[model samples]
Target: MSDETPIDFSSVLASAVHDMKNSLCMLIQSIDQLSQSSSHQSKEQAEELARLHYEASRLNTNLMQLLSLYRAEKHQLPMTIEEHYIDDLIEEMIAKNEIYIEKRGLTIEIDNDEALAWYLDMDLVGNMLNDILINAMRYSKDTIVISTEIINDELHIHIQDNGDGYPQEMIDLIDLPMQDLNFDTGRTGLGLFFARMIAKAHKNQNKEGRIMLENGGKLGGSVFTLILP
Candidate 1:
């Protein structure tokens, strides 16, 4: 008589995602090395390498998000809210994507006060913003702007692009309550859902963090806003 416990499929999936993330990190490093060493290669080859790097990096980011979501589900994700300078955080985000931005001929503009600081889980917020920035880089034709301002005693961080605005359906999906989001249909819903969860985790006196998706910004394109209290 075997009395073994049944496996939890979600936990197994999380384990798989962790393993996949490690493998992806190695692959990304290898691709980066190849890119740096192949400077003398042909233009087509260079472009191909750049494309490979970008896709791999994007995949790595998705894997990371998946792992974070799994941890959050299990209540294992750690939130360390601290005061961090807005400009410094934005600089790190830009630097992380500098290579891809250059390859795509994109410009990054920062409209944050250097001394402005915010209290939140930097790792969670940073990862969410990184994912958003990656999407912006993919869609923006030339310019992407990162801005922060305090609105009604809440911190407002906005990432706006000069690309075609998000589809009406996507905007609608984002506006839906997190419980109603369909995570299985596509990555868009899942990413936005994760972003919402991360945003909602930060709290203050009667106020909580949130995210908003809008179009027709200063750039006439899509805007992603994260508000924290």
Candidate 2:
């Protein structure tokens, strides 16, 4: 046998990611429990715990997105497109974010037809929205809105916030290639890049999903739209 390293680095990375996710899941749960526990007293302490919660959430999301991108690169990320009520879908996103919304004294708005059902990969799309909400929660002033509609035979989903709006760099990202992300600007391009990948994964007929970032929204801040076909 030829002398060679037996370790498959790709498999090793995937397994390491899986194990990291398990540990992060437990850490997230523990933080949630701690937040709910009344023994937490001071306002500053609570705030710190809440930040921890959000960071934990961010890390967990990062890992999940990594695994998804990996699978997608390997053509293994299955798209589970099915008809789901738009309200229920956004509601689950709101529920996951209930803690931060309450803690920050923020308001959330939902605008969608009550009886509309749309076909898409709910898990992938939902996680995409979750990442959006997490970013919005951190940046918004006091309000966020989630709206959905069928525009021109495609499902249009928008997540808007009431704040200063996305940075000029981020708004400029719409025109840049995926490989043009600047890492030295104290920003990691992973989340937005992941969002873009997710949008592209959803395809129907001859159309495909698209993502855009805009400065002005109904909330007068920034808007992130994922148009799915």
Candidate 3:
């Protein structure tokens, strides 16, 4: 028998997903432009536009998670760690989602020291934060609070939404590896899984980061915290 290994289907699948995501992004842009130019007073038209946007966003999120997981499995993911200002990161993230926030009448508050800097992989960390932000926007009533601080030698970032906190069962399952779940229940589980993976990947001087879920923050809602060392 030949010594060569079998073809890797995972890489092929990931590339396909990346291609599809790019196409979907183009489609979303076209739809957005059309929606902007064509004024429709009917509720059906508005609902359809909303549905298209939602699906596009969901697909993009899924594609991102798949790519991240694939890289993680191969240990090929780049951890480009750098020292960045926490406030600037929060500002940029909020600006990127301004349209969505305004459309949903949601308000976001950033509470972080402007001078605080930390070492991290900005792209991976940004993806993780974006996922958390999207989740907060979906479940929040009208407000979300993002905060950061340094405790001991670790940095802590918190994203909290003013919605009903996650049930105890859901919070308890976050640390475990990915598992099958019912889509009908409106749970992707990938978001948290991706967040956990990103957090664990961030390490400094032999210390690693961690993610935690809690309730009863300043927002009186669910809090997703990332602790980095």
Candidate 4:
């Protein structure tokens, strides 16, 4: 028998995800070019392009979350703490969703200081914000808001939506310890789980980042909050 152990399927899965993400990047780029040209003649064609753009965006987000989860499993994801201004961070998130926001007549409000700086992994935090914003957009009626503040020595980032709010069962998970997420509920659980993992990775003075979910905000819907120390 060969001395080498059988190949792990997990590695294969990771490779596949990487390939998919690359393909998605190309597709997203093409869509971006199309949006810039802004020369669609027929209403149906415009709507179709919008639909494709939204799905591709969601797919891209899902792949990113998967990569984050894989990194967590291998204990290879590193958090690089640096001082980054809050204004730039939230604006980037808004830009990521701009295509959908414009096509759907959605409203976005951002509340953050231009000069406020925080130390955290900017990429991971951005991914968390994008994931939460996508989730919010799915359930929101029209308005979504991104807010940031420093609360009790932790950076508080909130993405709120004005929809019916999260179902009771999903809300219950925040109170309990992290467990095997149920895909049966139509929630991939990757976004929330990845957010929690990224938050936990940033530690300062014995405290770490955390994720919280609640209903009733300025928009009277759902609020996804990340606290990073």
Q: Each candidate: RMSD to true structure?
A: 2.2, 2.3, 3.3, 2.1
**lDDT tens digits, residues 95-133, model 3?**
656546755668898889889999888878887887788
RMSD of 3: 3.3
lDDT per residue (tens digit) for residues 94-147 in model 1? 877776786677889889888999998887888889889988988898999999
In the range 27-93, model 2's lDDT, one tens digit per residue, is: 8778778778867458777777778778877887787787787777777788888899888888898
Task: Give the better candidate number (1 or 3) by TM-score.
Answer: 1
User: Which structure is stronger by TM-score: 2 or 3?
Assistant: 2
* Residue 24 of model 4, lDDT score: 87
Q: Predicted candidate 2: what Cα RMSD to the true structure?
A: 2.3
Model 2: lowest-lDDT 10 consecutive positions:
181-190
- Clash number for each model: 0, 0, 0, 0
Rank order (by lDDT, best first) = 1, 2, 4, 3
**Clashing pairs for predicted structure model 3, backbone only:** none
Name the runs in model 2 displaced over 4 angstroms: 1-10, 182-188
Candidate 3 residue spans exceeding 4 A from truth = 1-6, 31-51, 175-187
Candidate 4's C-alpha runs over 4 A off are 5-14, 40-43
Question: Which pairs clash in model 1?
Answer: none
The C-alpha TM-scores of every prediction are: 0.89, 0.89, 0.83, 0.90
